[model samples]
Target: ASATERVHLGPTVTNPLTRHPAVAASGIASINRLSGGRAYFGIGSGDSAILNLGLRPAKLADLHEYMQAMRTLLAGESVDYKGRSIHVKWSNNQIPLVMSAEGPRTLAMAGGIADAVIVHSGLTKDVLADTIARIREGERAAGRPEGSAKVWAFAKCNISDNHDDAIDEIKMALAASGHHAFRHTLEGKNVPEELQEAVRVLQGEYVTSQHEQLGETRNKALSDELGLTDFLAERFAVAGTPDECLAKVRDIRDAGVDNLLILAISSQTDDLIRRFGEQVIARI
Candidate 1:
């Protein structure tokens, strides 16, 4: 079997606020052409990209308008954007448009417009069900057919023979969820009160430069102070032996998620990818 069929390549997310819609459209279109249409465009309000620039994420209304403008430009039609007309001369709008959504409003908007929706929340039955229901509500409101928008679960996976050690690996990455902007997304999930309190404290003390990083000095201190090493290890990540991870993957698949993305929680990203492919993915 060819490796191509299993690989779908594209940006995880790009925002309308930082990059202009025409530029974004051109980038996605070029990737699609280069990859022979295996590219998908996943857009969202900026997270680290915008936050690092001392800016806020794009508004939901802006994201919707931006998506429309991108589609128009990619379809060879001139778009009236930012008081100027713009167009992409050589591109086809064949790439799938996905959205990396977290909140209910953004999730609904993605349901109505995007070909797929990616959620960063951990894989739990109740959370997955709730997220899917919100998206379905948006679809019904927009009169889109059932299953028109696919739901993808993005899980930070850290697998090892020692289950506890594997669980420990994702503690740093889980810190991102504790940030004020993203903290609410985990509110209604099956998180413990103590852990929630820890996250609240973390929101006050998080360093922007160390956002979503692993094994850093700041992260280690934070993890130690809040005692989040074991608390979030189980709830926010797919961490365990290969067998255990496979079981979690099965649960996610059975929960009606269209895709499961394993965000490798390791310094050696390439090694993790290879190991995951050989062990967990092959079994799944």
Candidate 2:
């Protein structure tokens, strides 16, 4: 132990460091005891972090297997595998399984297995509400009570006095975030072909007609190709003053989202974050 005492699962190919089932459980137990049951475990299927690692994406089934294995190990139960009781483990703390869900399969799995489910950024109210529905479906299948899946959302938000500047920043984030940061779940929600194409080309599979960097010259084409102009402004994120942004949050809440993890963007995040903390979030 470093006295600071930190151990993580081995590095994951897709996301951040991934813990093998046995190793992850042990570390979780260790942290739990050290923190007096205050430790938390979060599982994600490699996002851009995974992509940058030159690895394939993670699957929902894989997450479920990991969660089950962790639960079994931490509960002091030895699972029988390959003619042996494998990885005997135990802990006094209730190790919670939280899933970072995006697509339908992952959403359903989180609803069924995860103690809590977190929705990632580039969010739209319609998409958020639909994802939650899928999660609830998984809960029902598992015979769990209603609202068993605790749903939360994470977003890249930019708030500013100059709405145009804020819009530009949001556009840049959306242009790139589509590929790996967000999943394509808003395809047939009666959205435009161009916006759909933008999301699809980024996340789906479509080559650009021209050569350009994603954030530089190329993003404009990509945004235009995908028709992200209006939709990006409307559906993806909230960027504006406090009063303006709160309406967006209200819309997301009305769509059944439970909690929001806002990534406030600016030259310095403090200004935007403080404003949200003192004004937007404080009031709402």
Candidate 3:
């Protein structure tokens, strides 16, 4: 039996430039069926997945169109995608479409259409509130009811008794978060002025090929070299000992984050999950 109730394929790339919307929809639908209707399709406008392929991330317009086509196809309806009418014949699954967004426009668009949103912005109270407000704005603009789009706070987490080691393990993950969160624009992102330049430097230096790789990778080195490890950790991760993680999680919850999507990117991810489940989750 599956340990979790739902399985999500992404925050994977969901742009016309990468794959046909019908193919993406059909793939997720098959997962939904095989998982007994417990699958969610999580999408994003290409990051490492596209960059590694020597392609640019999808423009907002293309992402919007792709999302609409995926929604229609998954709903067992036909959609005109790039002058081609397509539909997923055997898939009529009500798969919840989750979107990962960091920038204001993307977040708003996700709120307007996605069944749920994974906010990859930051974890600070002000940032979270602002992000949610932007999502709500999108919902209103789309004529959707308040709270139509569920919000999930995206965080990098690692739990261990050795606090220092825990932090070290998550540096690469934090670097990935910073690269994603601040890559497009820094405005309205709540990044401190002092660190803005550093963020830019990190963005330019980030190696897409080494993304999320454990052990001493170039991306992980960038976090320290840019003097952004602590800041990135504070803004995007919940690491350290079990108590430390618990406190941070509580703070995030208090900031109105009801749902969390934790990225377990450490080498000891399995152990971290077991520890988190027992020490932090059990307490919460």
Candidate 4:
């Protein structure tokens, strides 16, 4: 918390199934207080965290209930659960709740309640537009003001003068898309019909142990076998010169996404961040 004290810091995601709502509230609240209220909490139905434990993601209903209960607890209010009421006396309720969602239903629910929605879909204009539409549906359903929830597009970035190298770098970052959850989101569009079988094979054989680890053996093998490295890189990452990356980000912003969380995809991490921040972010 101290290292990122001046910036907004929080877990990328937490789930209701593994951690109780009251406990989640307490932990996030502690960080908010420790960071002098600079905390932002993100929640989801669970992915690697739960999957590694052989547990399934929580249901939408459970996510909704748990998020509400967490909010109530953070506000220092007592909440009824199981057979008793619980409260966190030290909570300040200052943390902003963000929702990490991919599917339409979850995206809608997020817009209804979350301060922000992090879309894991590719940062294409079409995907951004579709994601925003779903969030608007939720906002309307909850009677919230239009555009109440800010949207963030998640993309891997490896910008450089050597465009080809930049593109190659992102291929390794494709580990994040090894799972069927991400592939299914792109089904019928970004992924072609012929590639569907490859995606299915990954759905069944994906190595959970290598989840999100760049260059993991299984991910590399699948990417090579199905030629998914280039395919996924073209659809999911931002690579090339700084100017090119900036243009892509501008388009995404114009498509209604409020922010971009660039996951640096490079062996030269420090240099990439320095150049990207100075050349791309500054220009934008």
- The top-ranked prediction according to TM-score is 3
Question: What ranges in model 1 sit over 4 Å off?
Answer: 1-6, 180-195, 227-231
Q: Higher TM-score: candidate 2 or 3?
A: 3
Candidate 1, position 25, lDDT:
85
Worst 10 residues of 3 by lDDT: 6-15
Better of 1 and 2 by lDDT: 1
Report every candidate's CA lDDT: 0.76, 0.64, 0.85, 0.77
| Clashes in predicted model 3 | 0
- lDDT per residue for candidate 2 within 178-221, as digits (tens), equals 55444546532434554564666666542223222223455545
How far is 55's C-alpha from truth in model 2 (Å)?
A: 1.3
- Mind giving the per-residue lDDT tens digits that candidate 3 earns over 68-178? 888889889999988999999787877888888999999999989988988999998889999999999999999999898998898899987888888898898899999
TM-score to native of every candidate shown: 0.90, 0.77, 0.94, 0.90
Give the per-residue lDDT digits (tens) of candidate 1, residues 1-284.
Answer: 12466568887878887889888888878877766678888888887788789987788889999988887888878989878999997876667888887777877888998889987645677778878888898898899997899998887777778987776666667666545224445555545675777777876677777776777557646865887766555445677888888888888889899987767887777877787888878988
Model 3 alpha-carbon miss at residue 186, Å: 0.7
* Colliding residue pairs in candidate 1: none
